[model samples]
Target: MTQAPGDVVLIGGGHTHIQVMTAFGRRPEPGLRLVLISDQTHAPYSGMLPGHLAGLYRRDEMLIDLAALAEATGTTLILARATGLDLARRQVLCDGRAPVDYHLASIDVGIIPDLSGIAGADRDGLAVKPIGSFLARCDAILGAAVDEGRLRDVAVVGNGAAGVELAFALAARLRARAQASPPARITLIGSGPVVATLNAGVRRHIHRALDRHGIARRDGVRIVAVEAGAVVTATNERIAADTVLISTRARPPRWLGETGLELSQDGSVATAPTLLAMGREDVFAVGDCATILEHSREKAGVFAVRQGPVLARNIRRRWRGEELERHRPQTAYLVILMTGDGRAIAGRGAWLAAEGRLVWWLKDWIDRRFMARFQTAI
Candidate 1:
């Protein structure tokens, strides 16, 4: 079936896609129509996720109601999973619905946490991506830990910034639950230095914070398997844990293998600097699901947030037969890690690193400001 001549379909309700919706809402195109296809009704704001886990923010406060936003913007919202795309027909294929046609499409569905290679993880480990489910799982585990009435050991697998903050958040939650009871033991297990890519000072600050919180650090050990009540290391040493959390980096969604678009080494859609899928102008990809073919950057939320404006402008420009704008991602952006204790670790550029309650306030201000951009008018 043919859609309107100017129908632009957004494939996910991610950060960049939300910007597109807001742009169209604030400015109208006489004949253009917008449709957003989202598998979930709520979009989690990345900056506030850790805070949510740490009980700093309520769940609803950290989630954007995509349905409401779509209604406010006059965009059709399809609550269905996009299985794949029929690029030849300019249509999106869904799980149980007829393909929807589009003149242009953008993808911002986030990456899946790769756990296929880790033995026993499927049954015993909890993944930290698809943040909503992870939070729920953590709650269940927290309940179980409370009933146990003893000091429980927790293992966080992965040493990146995410894994680190998750460890801290879990520690705070468990500590609060224990009160005068046995204090929970938390161990961060990884194969390398925590936030290995950051500067020496930043890593040191994180280490100091971990020490301050009494969280044990286990480095140079890869978690080979997650079993019931314990995690087995590469050398077969077992670390006892009541809960195991997997916070590994991106693993391309299995369905991406079917998409004809070019993909990067890590299996994300290969997008040009302009946020367009390489060799396919009709399709634009951003956020964690896309990889910039040139000037490679980490799949961090900063890039997606920065790309939103350019993506909106480029789409409008192309529709109006104007020149397109290329998105230039900053080489160095600020990094803030919440310690779950009213304090935060922050790093800017390459040389500076600091930790304090002031840093947490700064981070909170920036996060609230970003949310306000969409929340205030909607």
Candidate 2:
């Protein structure tokens, strides 16, 4: 193999980077080399994760194989965790291997759940990010419950879409596993109204779905701590549970603070509309690890998926020393809430809401199509 004149390093195999690598694979730049650094071999498609947990989809069905993608694209793949960056020298610091140098770089590392606000949560509760660890933890919980002949109680902390869908998905999974033993008792613990970020009509549908699943809902009460076998509330109320799942607010990785890149108040890399790092022309960032300075949005998978093409185009422009394009995200998009039982809730804007099996089928169709691209592409 020969070394190209310039090196373009992608720090993580995130949603946005997938598109960037695929584009460069199709249209090679003779003077540049492409490289990818990732901790996991398979990047899970988030949209199908809930279904996978509910036993509706297989583990492989939701995964994007980084090794295969790299091979197909003729990109070098490094299996290592990124620690920080040396901005002046243009190097990426890794955990075990030597530093990787780059003429141009991009970071797309995702966030983690911030459990500092709730005492003991960081120690006692399981986080649902990093995808791989969460799946293993779910398996451990289910296996232990089976060995004990029954699952006593399971509590999910946070009332957002992930938490809500997780509560229902776990309920369905556990109920099926409880064969001859007593039924599983699942509870949803929230600091505010269920799915508070969604519209009221969508919230109504989720409420109905919760009752139909026999999962108890405890809302409007702040959970202050995760005890040895229970969760304590701000008002000193305690709820017993055999297992605790944390799906709270997203927090940017702490290592980003050491990179010397200008970051937003939330600790994510501060980038312009073109996704270039502020005050730097050689660096860029996208997905959950970046905060678009001009038009900020919540840390959602949809925004990351949408950023894929824009980040791809801008990188090509920068490589050619041409003007970059701006990415203006839409104000609103359709929201799908999976019920874990062949039904889904679809909402857009502030007033419209619909729920039915057809909606679930629509969601399934869309997710499958997005995944099919990885198979047919680099």
Candidate 3:
């Protein structure tokens, strides 16, 4: 069945785009049709990612079923990767189909792990950027560990939230496995201080969590190369590991750079306060792929989730010839870090850390509730 031309084409199933889908589902604009284009049928929510890595949540639990979402939202779901964009033509180019024509387009394709310059990164280490690929590789690694009855060593490169969460999750999982046998030695290497963007209290809390898990932390260590069983640092230090997870320097999808859209120095799509492309009014962008001026926050799922309503409103307004509303992100939001067990740390700014199973429970409840909102109603 052919869709009578859509008003807006959303590129990618990232958090922000998903929110747009949900909002439009609840209250759709009759004239402004929405189409969602994504490579994955199921897009995982980033908040529950650490839990998935630690084997706490099943794949289904962590992922949002985009097919069902599209069905409920009355939006077209095209399961294909966006290869390019014709800004002047106001169309989206896909890998294996006719170029999709649209009056407006929003890109939330997310970021790709930057590993081109790191020697052997593309060849040896498994990049943890595309969540779907990372999940598959993680399964393989876990399966091998379970079969061999031991995992030698695992290295997680990067000091940001993703890296820290993944490192702790791996450590927790390995420790749990070791309780039954021998544990795998895990090391987290970072080029700068861990959680450098976070407040001091949050940083201290994470450091304590890492120590508690017995996961070794190496700071100010640049990864020069990734080898078969070792990661060489810029200082000529070699750290041995059986598995290497790349988790730093996220770059915008290459296609964005090639599309000739106004881009930030880092290659992110430049957008206005309404999240529309800088030069093209018909084009909008969100998530890690966008560089929104005025309120540039670190690439976190929270920000992406918050942008959904604004994006939805703006998209509809664009079709109706109405002014768009600007999105204002919270100056400070609560950060809850999971320990891969049934515990977590909650803190903001410089303050003592508070720990309890309740925090974990709160996190679980919050994540589950957020995910349930998007679950296909049977």
Candidate 4:
């Protein structure tokens, strides 16, 4: 293999980097080498993750094969965890490998649930991000319940979309498989109204869904600690549970803060609208790891997907000494919430809310199409 004149290193095989790599694969840039450093070779598509838990899709169906993508795109994939960034030296430090150097670099390392502050959560609770680990543990827990022929009490912390969806999905999956014991008891604990970020109509719909499933809901309650067989609230009320799942708000990797790059208050890499790291031209950050300074938005996958083309374009423009383009995110975008059953709710801002099996089918179709792109030669 020939060493190209310039090296473009992408850390983390996140959603944004997927599009970047796919685009470069279709149109290779001569004299430039592409390298991807990722801890996991397979990237899970988040949209289908809940459905996968609900038994609607298989594990492989929801994952992007990074190794295959790398081979197709002519990118060298390094299977190592990124420890830190050497901005002054233009290198990526890894745990067990030599430092990777890059003339141009971009980071799309996604976030994880911040459970460090929660007492005993690290030891007793299962986090839902880094999807693979959660999936594996989910299987084992559910498998144990099935094999033991006993009902299990499952608790989910956080009332956000991920937490609510996961709670319902877990209930649906457990109910589908009949055990000799009684049905599993699922409880949703939240610091505020569950799905509060969504529109009122959507929230009402989710509440109704929870009621129909006979799932317990605890709102406006703060969990002070997680115990072996239960979670203790601030008021010392103990909520009994056999398994605890965490789907709290996103938090950037701690290493990102250690890089000394200008970071947002939440510890995300602060970047200009062009997706370049703030005050730096050679480095860029995207996805959950980045905070678009000009038009800050919540860490969402939709925004990251939208940033992909602009990021790739800006990277090329910088390389060619051309003007960079700014990426302006939409003020409001379509929001789709899937019920564990064959139903989904679709809303665009607060103006519209529709729900039915057709909506779920539409979501399923959209998810499958997005996944098929990576599964094939593209």
**Which parts of model 3 are misplaced by more than 4 Å?**
1-6, 179-181, 350-352
Better of 2 and 4 by lDDT: 2
Tens digit per residue, CA lDDT, model 2, 1-378: 233478889999999998888888898877887899999998998888889988889999999999999988878999999999999899999999999999889999999888888999877888898788888887887778667765677889988999998987887687667672677688998989998878999999999999999999999978989988899999999999768898888877899999999999999999999999999898999999899989998888899999998988887788888899998877788889788889999988899899999999999999998898786655
Candidate 2: which stretches are off by over 4 Å? 1-4
Whole-model lDDT values for every prediction: 0.86, 0.88, 0.84, 0.87
**Candidate 1: clashing pairs of residues:** none
Local distance difference test, candidate 2? 0.88
Q: Write the per-residue lDDT of candidate 3 for residues 70-159, one digit (tens) a residue.
A: 999988998888999987787899999989988888899998889976899988898887889888888887768666865678899998
**Greater-TM-score candidate between 1 and 3:** 1
Model 1 misses residue 3 by how many Å?
A: 13
Steric clash pairs (candidate 2): none
lDDT of 1 by residue, 1-378 (tens): 133368889998889999999999989666778999998988889889888888899888888888888988889999899999888999999998989898889988888888876899978998988887877787877777677674478889998999999988887777666562767788999899889978889999999999998999998888889998899988999999878889886676767768799999998999888788999878999889898878788878898898898999988877776778877788899999999999999987789899999999999999988887777665
Which 10 consecutive positions of candidate 4 have the poorest summed lDDT? 1-10
Reference-based TM-score, model 2: 0.96
**TM-score result, candidate 1:** 0.96
Instruction: Evaluate residue 33 in candidate 4 and report its C-alpha lDDT on the 0 to 100 scale.
Output: 76
Per-candidate TM-score against the hidden true structure: 0.96, 0.96, 0.95, 0.97
